[model samples]
Target: MTALGPEGHRKRLRERFLRSGLEGFHDHEVLELLLTFAIPRRDVKPAARALLERFQSLSAVLDATVQELTQVDGVGPHAALLLTLLPRLLERYHQDRWRTVTTLGSTRDAVRYLQGHLEAERKEIFCILALNSQNGLIAVERIQEGTVNRTAVFPRLVVEAALRHRATAVILAHNHPSGEPEPSAADRQLTRKLRRLLGDLDIAVHDHIILAGPRYYSFAERGEMD
Candidate 1:
């Protein structure tokens, strides 16, 4: 039997991937195969290893911004774009799947969706899911990103976003980089402020969800909502 050359080795890798999946594949191997698409006729193993070293994980490599990805040695514009876009494309697929399976109101569905949207973020991010009368998504407006303070995330701004989207209801959400879903005092205050302001406008405030790494907290589930 002839020893496999570099091209033959790459072919076998692709074939093995297509036959099965990434069930038992190493992180660098997965990344190596992925990089093959963006970079032609070059060994991607080193590039993949470098990416893992810099980002610390395959998920982080895919989630990194283009600027961050390009900082790795051998990662060019095409490779950077490819790395960042793969996770984003998967995100859109999950969102589209969530839309069919569940609306914005279901705490279960909302949690699943929000996890994908905000779980990877390293800093605080607040977004509103605007729902129509049927409880379907109308628009998802980013309220702010930073410390969750009343000043940074104004109640008026949330209501205006909902109004602009012509939404009948809204679900508030924010991430806690500390990975604890427990709402801070400012989070509680902001939720109450938005609730009252949105109430005045006759729009229902459904829930406030806090995405904290793998775990999540729902105000409605905790009976914190009035």
Candidate 2:
């Protein structure tokens, strides 16, 4: 009897994936399956395990920058590039999901929309979701990106963008990489400042959302917005 060749083994992995959809596979196995798309003639199990060891999780492995990924043993530039492509594609896909999101009728709706675009981010970033007079979405624009814990958000600039879009309402959002969605004192202060400043311009501050990891805090939901 002939032992299973490398091709036969890969074929089995592919068949299992097609039948069961990764439900029974380990993390390294998933990476190995993905590597088969780009790597043709090599055993990718070691490379997949090395990537997980260096990055800790499949998500982290995909989110890693090219330079960071290259530091892993058995990961060359080509493999690293393939791994990094998932995040970029996901980012674009999420952006398209919200590209025509015109009506944010509920706090949950706003939170889910924000999560689709922001949850995977590794750093702090601020954005404005501008709404028309009828609370229809006009656009979602990133205002700034900052250090891990803080972003320099200028309320005046945000107001300017809202005005440019002729927005009558705004949903403010920022992410906390600390994995706790609780709003910090600084976050609360900034929210109050923007509410007052934009209120003065006859624009409504509908909500301020603090997203940390998978959790989210909505000021409107908490009765923090008047």
Candidate 3:
């Protein structure tokens, strides 16, 4: 058995990852691959292990706050920023894809669009999918972030943002960290409140989607919006 030096090891690892596309890689190897993008020249194996130990999983590490990422031994400001920005980049990609569709066809279409983009989140994020008069998606805005019990979503704020965007309709969405798609009593209450508030503004609240892991709950589909 031969041990490759740092540079040689990283070069081979990169080649292997490019060929195989993360299929059979270990957790440390995956972290190492991510770090290669962030650190470039540094030996990433130890750093990757440290990050895994600190955050438990790759998703958790990517989902961590900048402060939390900074606390890890090998993660500096630049690396933490890189990790934080990756999600935003993917979000922009999703938004771009959403823009390509001429109109939202059904409740399922709306949910499917969001599920592809937001199903893996570790924290609650409230997004407003703004639509034009023809029900075409105009923009998707992340209005707030919060813990499991509470999200800082305000009906007034949502209404104001919609008016600013000149949106005729809005679809509300939030992810459940606990991975249970069932809407809580609070979720129902919030939807009703938003519905009434938006009604006054002549902006229809199309749906309130609760994303729980792979599953999703739709207020409009279940007749909860009525």
Candidate 4:
């Protein structure tokens, strides 16, 4: 038989993909298409397969750190950079969508919006839900990013940010990649510390939420904060 040659092979595959969409494609095929956008004129099938083998799944590959991604065969600094940007782009999209909620009407609404924006993260990130005199959301600021087990959030920093935003109340939130929303002893201690510190400034610490997988635990709801 005869080789179809690179150009003809790529053209045929591209045509088929355009017609069929990604429904029947393998993981490597999907990666190949993504690579085509960055490393055009190159055969990206091998690179795609390599990435899948290394990362296990497409979502894992996309979520991997740049350094980890670069370790995959055929994934150099350029490919890693492109892969890393995808999450940031998605985060921006989520942030835009979250801004549509003008007010914090209920604890559930606040948790739903925040979990959508941050639950899938591998590391812990502390975010402040700043509110106005009327309980309207003013801004969401990411204060710190820490290891999977702990996120070091300074109460003073949170208080200062609220003061700057003219916030009358604030809801503190952070993710637990382990997906257990139950507040730990340390978590309880931190909430009490923040509440005590904020009380001096007359700024209310409304709640401290632990986001774990699809579930969330609210300190205020449990009567822990009251």
Q: Pick the candidate with the highest lDDT.
A: 2
Itemize residue pairs with steric clashes in candidate 4.
Answer: none
Per-residue lDDT of model 4, residues 1-226, tens digit only: 4337555556666777889888787777777777776776777778888898888888778888889988888788888888878877876776677768888888998897787668668899888899987889998888889998888888778888888888889999999877688888888888888888888888898888888867899988898886
TM-score of 1: 0.77
Candidate 4 positional error at 71, Å: 3.1
Alpha carbon lDDT of each predicted model: 0.83, 0.86, 0.82, 0.82
Candidate 2 residue-wise lDDT, 40-115, digit = tens? 8688888899989988988789879989988877678888888888776776787777777778899888887887
Give per-residue CA lDDT, model 3, range 1-226, as digits (tens). 5446767777777888889888899988877877777786778888889998988887788878899988888888888998888767776776567657767878877887786567656668888888998999887788888986568777777887898899999999998887788988888888888888888989999899888766888888888777
Q: For candidate 4, which ten residues in a row score worst on lDDT?
A: 1-10
lDDT of 1 at 162: 95
Instruction: Give the worst 10-residue stretch by lDDT in candidate 3.
Output: 1-10
lDDT of 1 by residue, 1-226 (tens): 6336656657867987999988778999998888888888887888999999999987778878999989999899999998877766766776666666436658987888877777666668889999988898887778888863322677878888999999999999988876688988888988888898999989998999998777899999999997
| Candidate order (TM-score) | 2, 1, 3, 4
Q: What TM-scores do the predictions have?
A: 0.77, 0.89, 0.73, 0.71
Candidate 3 residues lying further than 4 Å off, grouped into runs, are 1-3, 38-42, 65-67, 112-123, 138-148, 159-168, 177-179, 196-204, 212-215, 221-226
Candidate 3 lDDT at 183 equals: 85
